[model samples]
Target: MFITKVFILIIIASITNINNTSALKLECTYREPDLHWEAFSRDYTCEGTIRLDGDDENIRTVTNTHREQMRNADVRGLMIVQQRDLQKFPKGLERHFHHLIGIDFEDCGLTKISSDDLMPFKELLQINLSGNRLTELPNDLFQFNPKLKKIDLSGNLIMHVGLEIFNNLQHLTMINMHDNACTSDNAYATKKEELKELVWELSVECPPTLDMLSSSLFGSKEFIDNIKRISGEDSDDVRNELLNEIQGLEKIVQELKRRL
Candidate 1:
């Protein structure tokens, strides 16, 4: 009888532990003006900032309670940090705090973000997405956030950035692209006037396309087969054919160069 009672107790404890692990824990704090000035000095507001910290379960599960908390706060800035399970921008925040002017999503494990994720934040003035795993950004990611003044994309794995990504961002003043995979001398710019020069430099360093003819010729099956035949056998006909092809290619190159 005692053994059966102990077995029942073990089962109850296991159930309790499982329930605790699955529970979402969300902590929201309202920052007053004195506490918000350091992080949002450029765009300080009387509404202050609402900082939200949560575990993986809290991040994945957005309940009506969470939405009510943010709605009641009505802050201009929203900060969510250290959510490792967050692989993309949480669309739930937009529904709860669409009037947010600034957002800080640092140290999240974000791998991808689309334009739709940010289209709702039309009043956004600044965004900080540093220390994530982002590899690329869409060209029209900021089309809706025209009032944006500062952007922080540092400490990510972004490898390529299109010049079109900066289009229509005339109000942009500061861009922090440091510690990314694609680092150019002009990647970090502080002034709005330097945006044009930055785009020109990035274009020179990372062109949008490669020489198609050269790339195709080197990777073609016919080119590989011809090379193997020339090296494996002593066929004078094959050797002469290759030499004539090389001479013709040289003449074409010379003609193209003359035109240039």
Candidate 2:
């Protein structure tokens, strides 16, 4: 009876530990003005993540050391490093900022983004490499963090987004190539053609199992509200105007469909 009781107690302890471990996800918030760090800056014991909105220009000034200070203060969640030209600095320093969902480097002049620059952060959510000068990204770029959501490659000098670039990134949502030189009339026309072909090929190989749209798809709440002044769900006048334009497009589609 004593031995049986001991085994039961051990099982109970194991179950409790499992529950605690599962429940220990972290939570963090962007430090707001006036509210500052005090409101969201506890000992970082809360569970989930931290988000640095892409518009936060202050992130550019934050050094890896200062970010390390934030990490050592017991904050172990998402740290969104927005638009900092990390590659301009020496290598290995980026490995230090590996505490969060991922870093956003959109429009940060990355002519060459490698997987080595990203290998340290094992728990990355996604990394935004959009609007860079990268002609090619490493093949196994997403292999390290397969949970990657968005890889926005819009406005870059990329000739072609490789077919295998996204093979491991099942959770990837938006791969933006809009407004790129690749899409221009002058360059990468064939590669862009190949990119479109690959999208079609991949769609056939695997139907998209996820809805991968980022929150940035729609502008910020303030911008969306401003858009409402000109065009939104609540704006009946704007809706009517859009409906009129769509009505015109609908006529064109009808004619095309009839021709088909």
Candidate 3:
């Protein structure tokens, strides 16, 4: 009878412990930078935007959350940095989080990243930098992360992609850049039509060119599939037709601007 009672107590203790742990992992969101400073990792279950009125030192110290964790970190899945007015990003972010499969920094006010900042994560699968204020992308953005599978840099100010940039990322599957300005003057401002044309251009240009250059470029098929998946084009033939139409419209707009 005593053994039976002890087993029942042990089962109850396990159940109680699990309930407590699940309750502790509460998720929430905040807007102000001050709120994030105080509640950095306290509530890991949160998924709210940290909308900053302006840059603050308090907000910049988010790296401290990971610093303590890096002593014996084993994180997998996503890390999101949403809607924050960040003047600076965490240094050595990629080194410490080696197991990170994805990173999302959507709607954050990011201007530039040092070339060395994201070069260490050879195993990174996806990086989503949508809706930011990035102008010139780093030349060696994909050099270090050779195993990168997907990249989303939509809704930013990026004008003019050098041929060399995409040439390096051979294993890239999905690229979800919907609205991006690729003009030198306003790289951050992308029109709907402009985004369409850019997508078409990248799709047609990236396939044969990438394959011809690198033998290990495996994800070209998936990359093309990704382009079709997002653009809603049935096939390459339809994509080409759409591209021509958008290009024609763009040319007319350019001509009007020239006259003005």
Candidate 4:
């Protein structure tokens, strides 16, 4: 669901009598005389907007719910800006925000990410991981985020992702994967076939998602074999076969829906 908090902020935005207006809206203001801060204006387009800020810190550090800086009311549309040591995926955030709607980790020097790292924020609609050192995406990357609508993975070292990493993101509309190592279909590249799988899943109609229901309904043998082949060799064949089945089933479901 689209967050009502943003609307509420917009409703009361004109109240000049309020002591703290920044606590209501989603805007980033930059300090003058700092050329580095000026760059943030260009980097984060939202910085130019005149909305009341969430009143978040200049550096949003989220380790746990107990942190003095982390407040429950300000969990929506949070941004962690320019923290170089935020290399590893910080756990326990999921425990705090049961349905975190928006998150921005721009230029935070992120190195890795896992499904568990985001599972806590299951209802996240937008996520920005631009400017990171990520190399490979896990198979279950979006296993927990079915409602995710937009994700920015630009400017990362991402090379490998499963054929089905995005198949289950039911509401995903916008995804940016630019400047990554896996943008090639050339066999000589790091993982050509894996990247090809991502391309195959770029668009769709009706239902627009694949999940356990389709997995159980089709390609049972290949799915079973792919599970075992991971421990052995020749996983590509089984994995591709199952992915093809999943894609095919999605089309069949769409076609069936059209007929009705």
Candidate 4 contains a number of clashing pairs equal to 1
Candidate 1's TM-score reads: 0.58
Poorest 10 consecutive residues of model 4 by lDDT?
30-39
Off by over 4 Å in 1: 1-26, 33-73, 206-260
Cα lDDT tens digits for candidate 2, 37-155: 22123323222122233332122222222223454333333332333443331233333333555455556556776566566666665455666677654445565777766555666
Per-model root-mean-square deviation over C-alphas: 12.0, 16.7, 17.8, 17.8
Per-prediction backbone clash count: 0, 7, 11, 1
Candidate 3 lDDT tens digits, 88-144: 544444343345555566677788654466666666666777778876554356777
Which scores better on TM-score, 2 or 4? Answer: 4
Best by TM-score: 1
Q: In lDDT terms, which candidate is top?
A: 1
TM-scores for candidates 1 onward, in order: 0.58, 0.42, 0.46, 0.48
Q: After superposition, how far is residue 56 of candidate 1 from its true place, in Å?
A: 12
What overall lDDT goes with each candidate model? Answer: 0.64, 0.46, 0.50, 0.55
Error of 2 at 99 (Å): 1.9
Candidate 2 Cα deviation (angstroms), residue 256: 35
Question: 1 or 2, which is superior by lDDT?
Answer: 1
What is the lDDT for 160 in model 4? 57
> Which sections of candidate 4 miss by over 4 Å?
1-74, 184-198, 201-260
